[model samples]
Target: MTDDQRPGEFELIERYFAPLAGPGGLDLRDDAGLLRPGRGYEVVVTADALVAGVHFFPDDPPAAIGWKALAVNLSDLAAKGAKPDGFVLTIALPRDWTEAWLKDFAAGLGTLAGQAGCPLIGGDTVSTAGPLTLSVTAFGTVPAGRMVRRAGARPGDVVLVSGTIGDGALGLAVHGPDRPGWVAALDDEQRRFLADRYLHPQPRIALAEALQRHASAAMDVSDGLVGDLAKLLKASGIGAEIDLDSVPLSAPARAALMADPALAELAWTGGDDYEILCTASERDYSALIAAAAERGVPLAPIGRIVPEADAVRYSGKGGGQGFARGSFSHF
Candidate 1:
């Protein structure tokens, strides 16, 4: 078979991507997917791109690569308190693409797509000279004027986060070779937990209802917490005081942190955590936590939104201090 005809584009789509289609997908025959927000609703859309060796290692499990691609976008929708509508996928397949890899990738993508009720809509496939690259444009629906924004945080609003922080960065450390000397402290179980975190991140879709009801402002922590928090504060025209001690940590993260206090910087500022950093009124705090709990998501209050006029701006207290690292920067 010629290079261009290697499992021809249409053949590939029909074999792999079409099975993931939802009602709006039109069975992969149409050029565009269809979705309606219905009365009293709005559409929430988010797009994320992943490149080999940049976002993830090329040798990583095909299934994991597929899962991470969709999960990251879902994290954004969840932060906005939107229900998963569906997604369109565009992929640039490199010359090395194999049928087996694509099959496993589809399986992984379908698992989460099914779990979150986000199906594959319509998209394109093309050959690329560069690395294996993938992009997904996922959409969601929310009640009119109910999608949360980072600009809504007000003074005295409680700053909260869902799930434990720092696992992704820590997991990345032990994920591959050239391990930091500090990694010596992690046991086999600890290593797996961290590695799993890096490989498969869980998007908090279930917490959308709670956030819609209580959040004043919210955003996903894709770029380290402190940096993402800084962005949110700037957007909201506010500052915050985060209690370093209160930042939630998984047992594996805690153990890793104890091994080398320096890891705290990464845990605080490293990227890929994908947790929701949000704010709500003090009066709504208890209810929000309870609501999140009902969904099996752990919601923790780490700080409070402060006026932008505060002299301290964004400061951390207890145990670890300083925002010197800011967050992972692409530049």
Candidate 2:
């Protein structure tokens, strides 16, 4: 079969990208996705890109590529306490890509956009001699003057997280050949859990709005907590003391770390959780939990922000207190 004739993009898009009526009317194929924010709402925008062999592995599934591209961009809007509206896409395809691959990729993007109430309005496609790349721009709206920012944290604000951490980092450990047999023997369910965490990170969009009502400052956990929190502290001009024992972990994560002590370090430094991390005054703690409950997101208190100390500290139950290469640094 010729390249263009097999499993065309239109057919894949119809199955995955066609619009439906949810909280909003989704129209993935339309010239523009319609959005009507409530009265007194303001729009916010963020964009991100994932390049093959850099941001993602070469063998990663096409559907996953689509999901991660949109999810990462949405997390940025979520960090700003905005309601997702729609998005635009730009995809660079390798010259040898088959029509089936493009179809699956578009379908995957459509699936996520539908679930997140963000329609794919418009996009550009180009053939490239290098690796494939996907870029997405997401738009969201927040009530006038209610959007949250990283700079709002205060010295006494409590540090909190929406869900567990470290699953994605541990997943990367299993991806390598040097991993132990126990890790290599992980069952399908365990493998799938980590795989999904790495591929389809759940952007804390609804949680961002909930946080706006009570959180003094907020941001999504894109980079590991240590690195991301540093950014938060820098924005707020404060320092913090995190209880290492308080960091949450999934069942698989705990197991993987037990097999390899070094894995714990990876958990703290590894990124890609996509959960919401926030800070709020003690007075706002109960209110913040209440707001999160109303949105059906569980909020967990992980630590507290202290005065502007010269260093960040991590306190453990039996492991003592100090930063253990606490964050991921590009340099």
Give stretches of model 2 more than 4 Å off: 1-38, 175-182, 317-331
In order of appearance, the predictions have TM-scores of: 0.94, 0.86
Candidate 2 residues 166-272, lDDT tens each?
88776765664356565855667887787689887888877876777788998888778888888888888877777778888888887777666667766776888
In candidate 2, which residue pairs clash?
none
Write model 1 residue lDDT over 177-220, tens digit each, in one string.
66998788989999999999989999999989899999999999
- Top-TM-score structure, candidate number: 1
Candidate lDDT (C-alpha), each: 0.87, 0.76
TM-score of 2: 0.86
Q: For candidate 1, what's the RMSD? A: 2.9
